[model samples]
Target: MLTYRQTPPIPALGGIVARFSQRRCREAQRHVPAFDLPARLDRFIEFYLGEPVRVGTGAESPRAVPEVVLVAPHTRPGKRLQMLGDVDTFTIHFEPTGPHRLFGLPLQGLADHALAAPDALGTAVLRLRDRLARAPDFDARVACATAWLGERLAAARPADGLDALVAARITPGMGPAAATDNGRVALWARQLGWSERHLHRRFIERTGLPPSLHGRLLRFQSLMQAHARAPASPLTQLALEAGYFDQSHCIRDCRAFTGQPPGAFLAAWPDLGRP
Candidate 1:
């Protein structure tokens, strides 16, 4: 059986964090093919405590993943994951600009690649990993990780308000007045009192993708959530409600993000994404 737990970060780190989640499974589910959809908006930093996990970008096959991995925001799918043996994983789901705010790294550089945590943060991440591994219980693990994050935040430079502002706008419905207008980065720029090019540069630097692409991905996420909640809902209705131009537009977006046509997508993974 698979069990999962989710907890919010400390209030001080709330701006950069979405939540921390842990998942464990003593035996892999045989009936369902275990996999994960492409991450959108929030980046995922994962810590594996069991056998090496397998991940692949295509239907061809999967390769072993390292102990620690940071998955950047993504749209084009084909990313699949399979857990082996008994599994225990702790993950950090970061807000859109959290990668920049927390790690002090260029978000674009980390895009779509899962580099070793040690490689990304040198000894600090490795030290944290060791501490987490040594933790006596789940609560201890959470305490250790968040304490490490607090120290990192203390040492790291502060984020520009603009980065937070732009990242905030990329979410589903929480930002400036004009945030609801899809694909209108220029209008958002005007609303923020900044030039479009300037806003685009900051967005690429802090969130790894341009504003338009991020917005589209968020829209796609909405559709996926909608489908999960009400699988019987009409496709056209879900598409239009989620901001797709039409059913075809939704299908095209689904294909681009999941590498599967809408029907095939729903059929292949009725549960949609890994927990």
Candidate 2:
């Protein structure tokens, strides 16, 4: 049997973490189908305690999954991953600027890439992984990971000036106005007394995508989330509610992000739309 669970972060860590999640398969399996992870704006740090899975982009040969990996926001369509044998993994889903703030890594270079934890985060992660493997249950592992993250959070460099302002405004659950406005970058630059170019560069350094592209992904994610909440709703209605100009516009975004129309894409993997 396979089970997946998502748990919210503690109240104090809420700003840095979106959630903690676990995926486990209790028995070994001969064949497991690959799944598509649709493009999104959040970053993740995943820990694998069992067999390594395989991951790849479209049409490319999948590679063995790392024991611990740090994934940046996927600006491209998304990647494919398949689990074999028994699977057990835990993941930390970070806010848009969480990784940058916590690790002081420039996100632009990491965009669309998944790096081994040791390379991206150093040997300390290996120790954490060892602790996680030694834990008796999923909750124990979550506690271990949370404690490690808390230590990092305490030592993390504080965001300043534009970074602090942008981080405050653009979070994982930011509203549609900040996410759907096409001219938000220019408006923010003016409001913050910075040049548009400066704002664009700083935003990419912090979130791994330009403001416009990030907004587009946010809008697409909003539509998918709405569909997950109201599966019976018509695409047109969801599109309008998600800030798309029309159903056709939503279809174009679906095609761009998932390589299929909304009906076919969502029909193929109904639950993938949920966070």
Candidate 3:
């Protein structure tokens, strides 16, 4: 049996932490299918308590994942992950700016990379991992994670104006004014009293991708999310509703992000559309 649950962070930690999730698989002989992890806007810190997963890109052989891993915001497609044996995982999903503010890690260098948490965040993470492993239940694990993140939050630098702007305004699809991409970028720059170039540089520095590209990935994510919500919906309808110009546009993005066209990709991984 596979069980999964998600818990929102305490009100105080809402800005930095998105949520905490736990997934466990109890059947050792069960065949767990490999899935393509799509590029995401948020970042993650995952702790494995049971068998490590195997992750690989393209034709390369999958590698065993570390016990603790930090997954940065991916610009392109992500690695395929396959689980083996029994699995237990606790993950911290961070806001786009959360990891940079809390850990002082530059998003620029972390993009498209999954680093061992202990190596990136040092021994403190290992200590927290030990505590999580010993946690009595999911609630206890959340408490442990909350306490550790709270301590970090105390000394962490607050997000700057750009971070706040991106978090608040630069989301999937176009902004409220319904302007072209360049126009929206210009408007955002004016709000911050920055030139367009400065905005681009700062956005890349903070989020590991240009704002335009980030918006594209977010739009792609929205299409997948919509498909997940209504698997029976036609692709053209989903595409138009997700802010794509047309089905062809959506197809192009699907290929770019998942290396397959919409129908083939969804058919091959039917579970992706499951809620």
Candidate 4:
């Protein structure tokens, strides 16, 4: 059986960390599909125990994913992740601006990619990984990860004030404003007292994608999440609710982002293989 649990981050790190999730599967052999959807507005820091977690499949079969990976916001689909064999992992899902806050670095390199955390973020995470492997139980592992993040959070440099505010406001589920004139980058720039060009640069540096692309992705992600919640809802209604002008626009965007139509995407949601 698969053991899964999500716990809230410590209060001190709440702004940066949305939540912490742990998943363990002890069945000798298993396949867990990590779907490639729209550009995530957030970042994920993962720690894997037991076999290393793998990404793509070889000509013959798949392999284990890396021990630690920092997944940055991606605007398109990546190779599907098939976790083969027993696995254990705890993940930190951070807010859109969380990675920059946690790592104190430009996120351009990490965007649309998952790389070895130690290579990208350095040895601090590796040390934490070792402690996680040594911890006796779930609670201990959580404690270790939290303490490690706390120290880093303290030393990490802050994001540009305007950039942080803009990112925090560009959250998911912002309604029609997101897809129409209300979602324009210039509008936000004016409101934040930043030149449009300056805002664009800051966004790319801190969040990987510019404001325009990020807003579009957020709209698509809203539709996806709503569809996931109510699979039976009419596509037209879901489209409008997610800020698409109509069902066709929604369908087009869905195919563009997921490489599948809406119905097929939802139907294949339960299976990780393909749509």
Candidate 5:
């Protein structure tokens, strides 16, 4: 058993941030708990200090990033620390960003270096949570965590077009205006200059979901994000911008993917993301 507690949120440029404290490392669950978390809530800056835990983020299942993850601090089972930030909630790290190096390689790639162990990444995470136990202020703890992540991210890939595409697919902003029903996956593919197959391949490899599904979900997110910005946003417009033909179409997609109506879901989780 473990104790899980969330600190008050600290606002960032486009997201709300928080630090979590836990007693006893939590076990990986069958699924990463699903929450219509406030879209303002982005990723986190995790600092490992004591104990140990594992984390995975995917669509109702744990999966690996087809690309690579960079772990910082040269993770050592009980010694060096671990950390990350701005992480997409849906993304699960199969590898640490660094122990000292950049380019976030996979476990197999780092088998030779020090700060390696079968459970190095996950184990180091739990240690991070433990260290938070002694944190005097939430901001202080969060600052440490954020800086670590920033450093690691700086060392990693340059947010290449592929990464940007994934981000665009994962998180999109919506306008208050209604979207046209004419939207289609092919249309988006053309806009990105990618063949449907190429886009789908990279999206699935990076995200766990296919391009079409991602587009659907993100459309929902966009509409809702727009609504959050402007309460008077026309509902029909929301659906259209999100790629639905009409409000009814948006409702159907919501029910199919989110098991709730767009209206109710939005009402239930205010400021929470469309996903």
Candidate 6:
């Protein structure tokens, strides 16, 4: 079994969320309840010194990731961040932006550049684990960790920026992709003056997934949302609004991504993956 404890404090210059997880042998079959994590995240700082956790026995299999990008427990601070595959259970989150903060400049640009440059950010993060481990008190730990992050971020702000675009064809009421706007994505990227490759690269750097995959994830989320609002809605209608043309098309993608059919999944987790 797996258990988690979380202590979330007020948002600081950079938001901090701490989660402690304890789990026995991992079961890839285990499905973590669905949850919508915030859209923007700087990076996750994880320090776990207990039992080892494993994912995808063969390294390319669909291991239990957190249904999203996660910083795995065993990945120490200095190593390149390991993509936490769908974890049987794990908890860690960091959001650099909150309602208020004193630093007015963008830091993700710097962090990304630092992280990509010979893993400098990784090295600093590795030191964080050691610093926190030696901290003598609770207040000291938080203060020290926050300070460690602030210094690296202050110097490394990158020249580039992360951006958000209002997706034209994927909005709440947008019709099927085949009907409403088949090339909207290409047009939007062109309008932003970014090539597909550039867009995909930045997205992957920040989101841990390519834009193509991100599109699919968003579509899946839309389907799940529409279903929750009208449980009895026909599969055809659900598919159309969610950007799929036919029921079979939607089912195929759903099973491939979530490993479950829509109806059976809803039956088991009635509250949209929440408790």
**Which candidate comes out best when scored by lDDT?**
3
Stretches of candidate 1 off by over 4 Å are: 29-36, 170-183, 191-193, 270-275
The true-versus-predicted C-alpha distance at residue 195 of model 4, in Å, is: 1.1
Q: Order the candidates by TM-score, highest first.
A: 3, 2, 1, 4, 5, 6
Tell me each candidate's TM-score.
0.86, 0.89, 0.90, 0.85, 0.48, 0.46
> What is candidate 3's local distance difference test score?
0.79
Each model's lDDT: 0.73, 0.79, 0.79, 0.71, 0.40, 0.43
Candidate 5, which ten residues in sequence have the lowest lDDT sum?
74-83
Put down candidate 1 lDDT per residue, 1-275, tens digits, no spaces.
66777788888887787888877777554523666565465687888877677887665688888888877876566677876777778888888888787878788756667788777777677777778878877788889888988887886557665766666664565632244364567666777798888888878888888766776777777777777777788888778667776688778777787877877776566351432
Task: Point out the worst 10-residue segment of candidate 1 by lDDT.
Answer: 174-183
Clashes by residue pair, model 1: none
lDDT of 4 at 202: 78
* Model 3 poorest ten-residue lDDT run: 171-180
Q: Which stretches of candidate 6 lie over 4 Å from their true place?
A: 1-45, 58-121, 130-145, 156-162, 166-182, 200-208, 221-249, 263-275
194 in model 1: Cα distance from truth in Å? 3.3
Q: Please give me the total number of clashing residue pairs in predicted model 3.
A: 0
Candidate ordering by lDDT (highest first): 3, 2, 1, 4, 6, 5
Error of 6 at 113 (Å): 20
Model 4 stretches with alpha carbons more than 4 Å out:
28-39, 57-61, 159-164, 170-173, 176-183, 271-275
What's the residue-level lDDT of 99 in candidate 4? 78
Model 2: how far is 57 from its true place, Å? 3.9
